[model samples]
Target: MKRLLKQSILVLAMAGMAGCTTLGPDYQPPEVDVPQQWQSSLTEASTVADREWWKLFQDPVLDELIQQALENNRDLRIAAARILEYAARVDIARAGLYPNLGYGADVARTQSSRNTLGAPPDGVGRVGSNYHAALSVGWELDFWGRIQRSTEAARANLLAEEYGRRALVLSLVSSVATAYIELLSLDRQLEIARDTLKRRAENVDLFRVQFEGGVVSELEVAQARAEYETTAILIPAIEQQISITEYNLSLLLGRNPGPVARHASIAQLVLPQVPGDIPSQVLLQRPDILQAEQDLVAANALIGVARAAYFPSISLTGLLGLASAQLSTLLEGASGIWNAGAALAGPIFSGGELDARLRVSEAVQQQLLQKYLVTIQRAFSEVDKALISSQKLREVLAASQRQVKALKDYNKYARERYDEGYVSYIEVLDAERRLFDAELEYTRRQGNSYVALVAIYRAMGGSWVDAAEAVADKVDFPPQDAPESRHWWEYPPATRPAAQNQP
Candidate 1:
């Protein structure tokens, strides 16, 4: 019997190896067109996007805020937890490739009457007891690679989730930097409003005195007061905007709505360098694009799973244990028992359910393929848009600077003409109004230039994102609701401790 059992096992192993044939299409990355060079380029600045580009601003406060956001942001935490979820699912899918072993034991007593339809002989009274115990195993042979295909799809999903986390980190870093720049801009605007208001107040005082001395008319005093009130109104509005920006930035840092620290003024922050030599193919490394492709890979593998379902499923089951009717002889060697068998099941007719499933899988594959292609196209478009904006915004800022300088000189000359009795006070008020508006506009464009730089770095992802994520990983986030007690299957010897929290 032992020899026969060994021969049966050997034949099953040989048949499984010989008949293995994976079904459906294998995954291949989709190819899409890429441009040779960006349409708008900045050739003068060094390539800062290859590394921690946010540090180019040289603001320690900005750096600290970004680090804080990376560690505490809720979105990032959710993404990390999703990665763990997918990892567990991968293990669940791979489990089908191995045998499922279980144990069972039971004891029962029964009483029978002679008058029953079926009864024991008269010599045997009516009461009886039975005991049984067994170690059983059931395994499905992968002749058509259904389990392999399912495992493949699960692994791809795990990769996609990992990339999704990295993409969130990239976005978080850029968002913190952009918000900081905006805060500085608002600060500068508030300063401009206050300074204009102070100067206008002095004008109102002087014009009133001249009117009382009969050197100026009441109309001139009224005009001066009107200008003063206009400038005064701007101060509260600018202050309100500053408060709103601070509260929003505080939220981005994953803190309660409150003030955010500022290390440098708008003019003090260094501008980030825009890298011009980026190749079009480098966009493939963007985490969002990579995540989308992984989704496509998983979808492609599901088609194989659907196709494999059409073939026959062969399973082997075995039981080896003891059974006895007498309680005293339950464990005796004579009571030992064993059994083994094979089963084959296949679809005969499912009312078109199998056909519909296959069609659905194929349709999902097509949808993900289109999404993958569209992601690449969007990445290219973003890079081009950021590059063009960065280059043109610099020109806009420079022109605004020139406008402010020209308006300052105009205000100075107009004031001199008014004091020398060569022009009316209206001319000086016009000059000052223009200068105030021009200064505010220049500050706004200055802030936008920095924001454009952030956009370019974000659009052109590279090794820098990995470096940022490394910093984020240093903070050991709590396990996502996973129990501290772990099963043997959850703590596989093949996986590293750093891979998951098994216990």
Candidate 2:
């Protein structure tokens, strides 16, 4: 006992003093090459980005669809489940701060042969049984906070996963809005196609009559015929595209292909003005950036874990619970025994394995730091690029809308001239083609602008919460009444149809 106690004290002292010099170099976060200022229209900033910007677009159907996807998306569900798993791990880590206690008991009847080395008076020898049991307690001392550092790493990783999930939520919302907007654009373009086909049909009939009376040339008739068919052909192709887009949207809603409703045509819906929030806002609100930072913190903690590896470790193993061989005697007397011992251990002549491990950990941390910086650079680039793209696309769309207007006026004059016999049918056909082309270009631009807006919102990350309390409020859902209630399938039955006014 004396020797054991002396050895225990020596190991504890060694653990306290071991590795006075750490093997690995301290870690530092890598620097990123970032522009001092944004390269786009971010000079006029606003705090409105912190709100659910999608709702700002005022498409209730769209909001509901996104809510459903958030709850029903299989990937999101999987991510949420993983968070629970990590939470369980946190419980395990926190448990390490305390000891584990266990108890045991047993009962037995025995008999032995007479020929045994030390036989009893009866031939059957060594045939005696007694009741015995004990309780044990065990815990590893975290004198260097290895377990605590490790727990911190685990917690940061959990936060990273959560941020990843929120990024997905942001993406889903943006994608649904983009698809819905494009659908509206297609609807408008289809309307234009049908209208153009109507005028071309009338021109075709007029040219046929003139050809029969020998008033217009054969070439004129052929040109009108070609124009009519060319415009007619696009209708079917566009209808096909609309179908596919609808199917794509169904998949996003976690369902099979079906029609979706909305409140406005492409022309009626208000184009969202990009709130010129500064680039600095992105640093705090972007989910990917936060996730990257969390990963950096986790990597930093791992260095501590490895650094602690160079130090001696002390531990406690004790027996302190009730146990007995006889069920009746288990708790009848103070016979249930208890025992405890403190242990101390440290690296001795590990052939430099401990030192090598520390180097590897430091190297890993350095790589993570570099990656963290690169992630930030890329995030900033995306924000700047989205900002610029949104502005440029809106300008192009405005120009295209004006071009369509001009072409429409030109078509009116050309048609009147054909009626007065000032021009041949060919001129009218040419005017129709030009106007149709202009309308199509305008519709395409409209579609592209909506998609770019979605990209901008997603690039900025999910809703930016400026306060820790906001985060807590979002995450504090009671387990039984989890946020999963907002899933698509569980939408409020009393809510109005999302797109009743706009087919």
Model 1 per-residue lDDT tens digits across residues 345-449: 999999999999999999999999999999998999999999999999998999999999999999999999999999998999899999999999999999999
lDDT of 2 by residue, 380-484 (tens): 788789888888888898899889898888889998997897986667667778888988889889888878877877776634422222322233322454554
Q: What is candidate 1's local distance difference test score?
A: 0.84
Q: How far does residue 353 in candidate 1 sit from its true spot (Å)?
A: 2.0
Clashing pairs in 1: none
Residue 358 of model 2 has an lDDT of 78
Q: What Cα-based lDDT does every candidate model obtain?
A: 0.84, 0.69
lDDT score of residue 232 within candidate 2: 92
In candidate 1, residue 474 scores what lDDT? 58
Candidate closest to the true structure, highest lDDT: 1
> How does residue 261 of candidate 2 score in lDDT?
74
Clashing pairs in 2: 68-488, 106-325, 114-123, 132-324, 132-325, 133-323, 135-320, 135-321
For model 2, the stretches where C-alpha displacement exceeds 4 angstroms are 1-36, 42-47, 121-126, 277-282, 321-336, 345-356, 462-503
